[model samples]
Target chain A: MRLLLVEDEKELSRAIKSMLVLSGYEVIQAFDGEEALALIENNFYDGIISDIMMPKMDGITLLKTIRKKNIDTPVLLLTANGQVEDKVEGLDAGANDYLSKPFAFKELLARVRSMIKHYSPIGENTHISYGSIKLSIATYELAGKESSIMLSNKEGKILSLFLKNPTQIIPFEKLVSFMSCLDAKDKEIELYTSILNNKLDAVNANFKLAKLNKGYKVASL
Target chain B: MSIYGDRLAQLEAIVEKGKTLIQEIINEEVKTSGISPIEHFKYRIKCEESLINKLNLRCLPVTMESIYTNIHDLVGFRIICSYTSGVRTVANKIISNENIDIILSKDYIKHPKPNGYRSLHLIVKLKDSDVPFEIQLRTIAMDSWASLEHQLKYKREIKHKDLIVAELKMCADEMSSTDLTMQAIYDLIKEEN
Candidate 1:
């Protein structure tokens, strides 16, 4: 998962960023809300954690601004005060959840996980389907009319992406980013695509991955 | 019969009760304000197949306990209003009720989806039940746009998908502008009266 950590306190921000990175998440750090807003405008993150009290703009104002601009990225607000009014204000401004200061890192991680899971479309749905095939996200099984095949984790994730956006070409950059494999080379992605195509053929799936100019899309056979 | 058959029935009952409660609130509001905020409402309980699929997707054990704890939108209500102002008014009244506990509120109307879908979504629990249900409030224009967008979005085959998506977004923006103008005209007529 990719997360943006916005905290004015440099030392605390570093600490949190390091911890999240260690936990297998891509973490981006911004010193204040303005810098964070700039990054937010250009990039997409699974979740954002911002402190309520900041130098340039407070987290509440930052949140309200983003909401007005129709950015629906989930936000978790951090506040020094644990008062009910503060929490109500943050939520009323569009924060998904709130955590007070002096919280355990474990709790923060848990909240982050919950927030991302709740916001993800795949997390809410049981299976994704296109044409005559279905892929069960939980089991990593792709079922065609005649048979079903167990897919590797990477293969399942790749197929899920195509299944979710059937007929629409997913660019290489987006496919890699969505997989959280920023370091993956083009050849590596090509190999995975080929393997996935072979699996589809084995299972007699009605759809196959077709390469476009700079991306791939699921096309009916 | 599946083990969850009884649980599904129970959820349906909860939805029925929630609808009745909301109707009562609307009735009281109309009695005093001389106008109804809600143009119409629709309610549903999640189907058994979907419930099972959701459980499997989350990797949760297929048990009644898991359903109660993990699922929040087993029952849902969609409220359609004639204008944007009516949407807010209806939402305010529903949240003010003592019998409901607001667990989450997402003002998609203020912060719409990137695709331009707009609505105010609330996840709440009735006082008598631990089950949480979702309430969606949107103006007629928004409802119509969202309904059509949802249908087109899930289709497997479409030529010029990007163009269709852009056109839908344009339509949504235009409808929203129209809704605001209609609201402003209504306000002016009310002032004159």
Candidate 2:
């Protein structure tokens, strides 16, 4: 995914850019909203994260301009202000989500992933839920109420297939069809599934992956 | 003249105004009447990609006229409440409005679909704007059920579509009962206090 991060602080911007790049996203930086708008005119971004306070232009104004141009790119506003009204203003101006300053890095990543998942091309299949565990297919993130962790693309697809057909014993053949790895053996499947199960345990997810007669199924913990 | 631009502006206005009207109603009625009927509300305009995909899928001409006449759900507002009574209450507010005409209403809550889909869908036209849009009133359980059903329906490939549909239909029926039981418990608690 390609993302545009607009922030006035160069140090903070670079830090965020590096973090996003590490997570397999192509990111571009803009110092202010005007620069962001110019960059947008020439380049396309799957999502945008803009600071509400900026030189020459602010995030809210940029949101207005983008919407006025009929570009429905998903925007996540980063604001120093924490009031409900300010958040409401951002949303009313057509922002998809907002994050407060001094947020944890994990929260920022989660919000950015949320924006991307919400605006991704296969928009309908982006987010899926089963009970308390919500999965974002675009971001490869499985989020429970108390915690969340990112998954590899293959793991995400595998978990998603089970969630879609909850309580059903997915046969090995059926599970293999969901994986793109042609030479995926049973041992390799166990490795990926173990990683997913460990993450689920960390998150205290109500569901667990367990072996059925032939394949795996998700059962309540 | 930019007729297309003007139409887009009108649609935005209808969406903004409709949201404000509903919000104001909830603010006033919930405060004075001591009953909070709405859990949450959201509005959306069909994005360009989805619109184009729909036009091609339907084999419709890519013309503004075709869109204006047939794309009744281009602008959608979903109002979710906690109980069935709240659905009727909110729908009545829209129906009784002087400047709004109810083009038609699908009473799915009273008579659910064969697949156990239940929600109240109203197609309405504003008197001054002359644009038709859809408003969906549903309980939270119904909304959740519809979302899951939507996910099931939109898969590009499914090995057993019939089996999935059957399972989803059964889940929807169970959810409807759960909603009724929750509403009853809420009523009992309110009566006690």
Q: What would the TM-score be for candidate 2 when compared with the true structure? A: 0.45
Best by lDDT: 1
lDDT of each residue in B53-99, candidate 2, tens digit only: 88899999878888888778888999999887688889998899887
Q: List the candidates' TM-scores in order.
A: 0.45, 0.45
Say what the RMSD of model 1 is. 25.3
Residue B163 in candidate 2, Cα distance off native in Å: 1.5
What is each predicted model's overall lDDT from 0 to 1?
0.79, 0.77
TM-score of predicted chain B, candidate 2: 0.92
Model 1 chain A: which ten-residue window has the lowest total lDDT? Answer: A177-186
Interface RMSD of each: 23.4, 18.0
Specify the CAPRI tier of model 1.
Answer: incorrect
Model 1 lDDT tens row, B77-176: 9999987779888888889988889999998776566676889999998888878889999999899999999888889989998899867865765566
Candidate 2 per-residue C-alpha lDDT over A4-107 given as tens digits, one digit per residue, 9 for 90 to 100:
89999999999999989998888999999899988765454668899988999988999998777645668898878566777899999988898888788889
